[model samples]
Target: MVKQERAVRTRQALVRAAAELFAAHGYARASLPAISARAGVSTGALHFHFPDKDALAGEVERVAARTVRELAGRCGRSEGSALGALVTATRQLAVTLAADPVTSAGFRLGGDPARRHRAGPLDWWQAWVRETVGRAEAAGELADGVCSEGAVVAVVAATAGFETLGSRDRDWLSRERMDRFWTLLLPCLASRPPTKEPRP
Candidate 1:
């Protein structure tokens, strides 16, 4: 147990260091040796834990996914509406992202399946979003035929798009935009009332 704990600590440090460097310089620009030095680990030890840079990226992706799972677990308890919970999660994600650029970078890098740790964190988010939407529907907060899978994909895509936009347009990433996102998302996920129209 003691040995396992020590190994876990070492891996965690490596992920933290690598994440920061990758976020700052991007995955292609980051070198393993720099990551090793930043994490205070010898190159050999770093190699032992992660055989290559891609492996390191995988670990970072896993860590980001795990963080989302933990956050979703907490958010599940809210008695708030589905739209409200979704908004809350988005805001928290932005804050959490600002604190840990490495994890955030993982998502950006994974935006290309041909590059980076492609699916780790993203898969986790997809599952969690599906589950959350499923729960909301069960509580009668969503309409019939409201596909959880579709909602999950939409939310993830929307988030990735916003992050991309935020990276480009710093001024647009705001609390107000978050609210606007909620406005757009709720109707998509909500049960639309039957509409009346004049006969053509």
Candidate 2:
């Protein structure tokens, strides 16, 4: 039990250190010694915790995925329509991507196909968008012919494209823009509300 606990603590420290270094320097530029030093661990400790750089990279993605998924859940409970939920979620993610170095760097690393072991955090987010959009359309909140799959593709592409843009000097995709996207999407999905019956 003691060994397990110590191991867990070591792993957590490594992840935190890696996140900071990777965020600051980008993944390709970060080295095991640097990460170990940042975590206050020996190089052997890093190797013990993570068999290779790929393993560490996978762990980073998992951490990022957990963070983003939590963010997505918060979006769902937020005040708004289903479309509103999606917009809120995405906008929050965008701002975080722009503001947080760890998040931004993790995603950049996840972009590499050879390195990724998980569902690709970006892909997961896109799948969420597609599912949410499909549900909203089915519920009569969006315009007809909205094309849930295509919309997912677009949202995924746009989000990544924005990420690749490195969050510098961009005016688009503000909360307002997200709202606008929703507004344009709604009319086609939602049918008119049924008229109320006459009072007796």
Q: Per-residue lDDT for 1-200 in model 2, tens only? A: 99999899899888878877766666677789999998888999999989987788778777777778888888777635666666667778877776655566567676654453456567678778888878767777666666777667766777787677644544553555555654664445445421221111
lDDT of 2: 0.70
Clashing pairs in 1: none
Q: Which predicted model would earn the best lDDT?
A: 1
lDDT of 1 by residue, 1-200 (tens): 99999899899899989988877677788899999999999999899999999998888888887787666656555525554566567666655665666557666667644463467666677666777777777777676777777877788888777666766565345666766776666766677421321011
Candidate 2 — which residues are off by over 4 angstroms?
Answer: 1-10, 20-28, 113-117, 167-200
Weakest 10 consecutive residues of candidate 2 by summed lDDT = 191-200
- The TM-score that candidate 2 achieves is 0.74
Q: How does model 1 score by TM-score?
A: 0.75
Q: Count the backbone clashes (under 3 Å) in each candidate.
A: 0, 8
Residue pairs that clash (backbone atoms under 3 angstroms), model 2: 140-190, 141-190, 142-188, 142-189, 142-190, 143-188, 143-189, 144-188
TM-score of each: 0.75, 0.74
